[model samples]
Target: MRNREETYGLIVETAYKMFAENGFDKTSLAMIAKEVGISKPAIYYYFDSKEKLIDFLFDEICKEIMDQYAFTVEDLTVNNFEQYLLTIGFQMIEEQEKDVHFNKIFNEYILLATRKERYMKQLNKIQKGYFESFSMLMNHGVTIGAINQENVESKSNMLAMVIDNIGNFILTGLELDYKGIWKEAVKSVLLSVRND
Candidate 1:
């Protein structure tokens, strides 16, 4: 005798686990229904189609991570820009390690986004938000004389790439010194534009 909300939440949770472990390609409505102890039609009651479910998960992932890292440029000192990059990099690694299921689903969505218009819009909105934040931070750095204004957009793009991919180190469970590597990357990409 579950309410609609409980059943819907249960479906999402079960689907996330199944997709993360078995992959999205192999998962089917029948499989999800079997796992959730619901009929296939029951799943349709919550999600019209698999695509809609993926869309829902995409939003879920976006909301889950986008809520973090909300900081004003005024709160950040230009001198701490390198540490800022490190914080973003470390956060990615920590998050991926904390929930491999979430990380796997995120990667799957990234691949799907390439071919789906809806996913592209969602992904673009998320990335645009991050790009704007990085660009503004770099602009602030330049204003404070910590960095130059040259190539602000390109530099922001590079930093955003680093933040997005630094989580791979944890995904691979690599034993190398990732912090050392990230520090080198930050110095090369960002500190290279220092005004001083």
Candidate 2:
């Protein structure tokens, strides 16, 4: 018999698979329970409702991004700043390459935001918070004399836009060299930090 943690993990993973294969609206809790070989009431023990399950999945995805940020920026220093940007850019590409399912489901939530005011507000808040967070880092660089003071806001915006959309860009199935293009894109930010 699965322990409580094991049952919860199975439910979440199975629900993500089902949600990715079928549209979120089309995937019901009963459907997930059937796929997991569990009773519908058992699923209710883990997730009270389908929306709550999605909320859990979405939160998990966000948690993944936040967790990555911890390690991504943990070693940030002016000396390694350019390499830092490249590392982050390339990592974004790699993650998107591997997690297309999460990307698709995330986009589905974005589409849902179009019709649902709560989701729209949440998306707006998340995007703005993302922008501000990156901008704050750029400002810190300026304060520390690592990043140039000129056009810091614009630089932050450009980099944040690229970072935020790497998943969407991958989903577009463009065959362009993302790493090379990102190298070109970060050149603008690199100029401010790089001085021989």
Candidate 3:
């Protein structure tokens, strides 16, 4: 049973890599099976279909991001929301760097419209939840004099959009300087909110 579970993990990881390298639409079960050194029938033992495999990969990545975000924000206090924002963004960038396939999969999701309406709806909800969570933190910052209270939601959304766009830029193109871009965006946001 342990070996069976390990093999399943391997198949999932291999399929994730293949899907990352190739877009979701282009990745086929046969291709993933070949890459994993398994017969197509063996692949079926793990995932019923290519769509299911993709869904599993998407769920895995989102779970990882949320877990990492939770850990990163665990010690954060509301007084320094700007710092926390930068810390969380940079931590996400760091975690993302550890896996190239993760970026590919993430980029694919941002670029591709899901054929499954439920997944598409869930995606929007997840994105909005993240934005709202950060905005609430920023609102706390207002009470503590860390952020401007005026138009808090709009400003929070704008700040979050900067991070999101920078992430997309880094993941989609190798020519871009990801580290520098991430740092610059964080710095820019901090400067905008600084009491000075």
Candidate 4:
């Protein structure tokens, strides 16, 4: 009774659930079809293979990050650049907690990153985008003398590393005590930016 769009939605939704529950490698299309109460052939009508399903999910997660970037940086300018980064970090942690796929993804990708270079490329792209955004913000800050003009690349890379490390920690179920860890980490990163 479902339309093609509905069937595709069901397939994606079902696969997402299974992937979250058992991770990408453990989850199978047959299991997803069973979970959706559909035949494997029927499921294939929507998703031809598990890799295709994962590809779709990967894009979906990347889109979520891209979408959040808009809201997180909407009103950000040179004056409040630090606050902008902090806001985005905290918001991302909260959003990652709400979505099981996000958490599963961190675990899955980190565990298999070396063996999965193509998928890892997606992760790299997202991280680089984050860095570029921060670099632009830092450049603006320098223009206004709020931040240093020298060593922009180094400063941006360090900031990006801090954020990436934080995300990795959170994904590992490490209690960051954000208020404590973030303040110190931010200060250190800013010191590098200001050093220039």
Candidate 5:
């Protein structure tokens, strides 16, 4: 079972790299199998089809991001909101820097989601989950006198949008200093909701 899990992870990672380099439409299951040093049947044993693999990859990435968010906001407080935002922003920047191919593949998935109804549905569902989590955090802040009780829903939505856009910008290879820009953007959001 452990080996199966490891092989599954390897196949997903290799397929993402190939997709990043050659694109999803251009990448084939045989190529992924070859890259992972596995037989085509082995690959099929794990994933029924390329589309299933893509969906699995998307879900896995979403789970990881959500897990990170949960950890980041575990001890949420108004005083620490800025620090937390900065921490997450920098962490995302570092992640993108660590593997340009992953960023490219993620960006490509975003683009593909826009053109495909099924992919777009999945993306939207994930985004809605993010918005809900952010909204809950802001509502908690309001209850604790950390944030002003003014349009918490809208404020959360705005914050989520800003964060998502910053990520998209970074993934698309923006030339500016994204870390600095993200800090400023997060600061702005925090200031906008401060109880003071």
Candidate 6:
């Protein structure tokens, strides 16, 4: 079972690199199999299709991004929230900007999702999970008297939108001051919800 899991990991990693370099539509299961030095059948055994493989890869990447934030609801005090938004949030944007290939592949997947119901569903699930994470953080801020209690849901949604836009800008390879823009946007959201 352990060896099988390792092989599965290898397949996913190989597929991600290939898709990043060559694109999702252009990268084939056979190519991934070859890169992993496994048979195409082995790839099929783990993931029935390329779309399934991409979905798994996307989930893994999202988990990594979430993990990078390294903050929880308990960490949402006024001081901590500002520090996190400035430090960890900026770090997340910077890390994302460095992954040019992955960003390209991500944007491509988003575009493809618009045309395919399965892809759309998968994307929606990932997005909802991210939004919930932001909402949880906002709820904690309210509890700690760092944020206004009025319209917590709307404030959370707005903050989440700012984060999403920053990510989208990075993923689309927009030539702008991402960190500066992110800081400004986050500050704006925080000011809007400030308890003072």
Query: Which number leads on TM-score?
Result: 2
TM-score to true structure, per model? 0.78, 0.85, 0.80, 0.78, 0.78, 0.73
User: How close to the true structure is residue 163 of candidate 4, measured as C-alpha lDDT?
Assistant: 62
- For residues 85-184, write the lDDT of model 3, one tens digit per residue: 7677776666666666776787677665455675676678667776876676667666666666777787668767766666666666556665566667
Model 6 spans > 4 angstroms off = 1-11, 33-52, 65-71, 192-195
Compose the digit string of candidate 4's lDDT tens values, residues 1-196.
8787877788788787778779888888999998887888888777788888888887887787766655333455656877766766677666665664667665666566678888778878887787787777667666656566668777767766776676666666776585456566556656655666
- Tell me the number of clashing residue pairs for each predicted model: 0, 0, 0, 0, 0, 0
Error of 3 at 16 (Å): 0.7
Q: List candidate 4 stretches off by more than 4 Å.
A: 1-7, 68-78, 110-113, 189-196
In Å, residue 150's CA in model 2 sits off its true spot by 1.7
Clashes of 1: 0
- Taken over the whole model, the C-alpha lDDT of each candidate is 0.76, 0.78, 0.70, 0.71, 0.77, 0.75
Candidate 1 lDDT score at position 185:
66
The reply for model 5, stretches above 4 Å from the true place, is 1-6, 71-74, 111-116, 192-196
Ranking by lDDT: 2, 5, 1, 6, 4, 3
| lDDT of each residue in 43-120, candidate 1, tens digit only | 999998987787788788889767654546665666676677677667766676678787677778888878888878
Cα lDDT tens digits for candidate 5, 1-196: 4498899889988987898888888999999999898889889999999999988887777777777556335577767766766787688778777777866777778898888887788768777788887788777767756667777788778777777777667666767787888777666656755536
Tens digits of per-residue lDDT for model 6 on 1-196? 4488899888877787788888888999999999888888878889999878887887776667557544566646777786676675687777777776667777777887888887688768777777787777777877876777787788778766776678778766668887777678667657756546
Q: What TM-score number comes out for model 5?
A: 0.78
Q: Once superposed on the true structure, which residue ranges of model 1 sit more than 4 Å away at CA? A: 1-3, 189-195
How far off is residue 11 in model 1, in Å? Answer: 1.5
TM match of model 6 to true structure: 0.73
RMSD of 2: 2.6
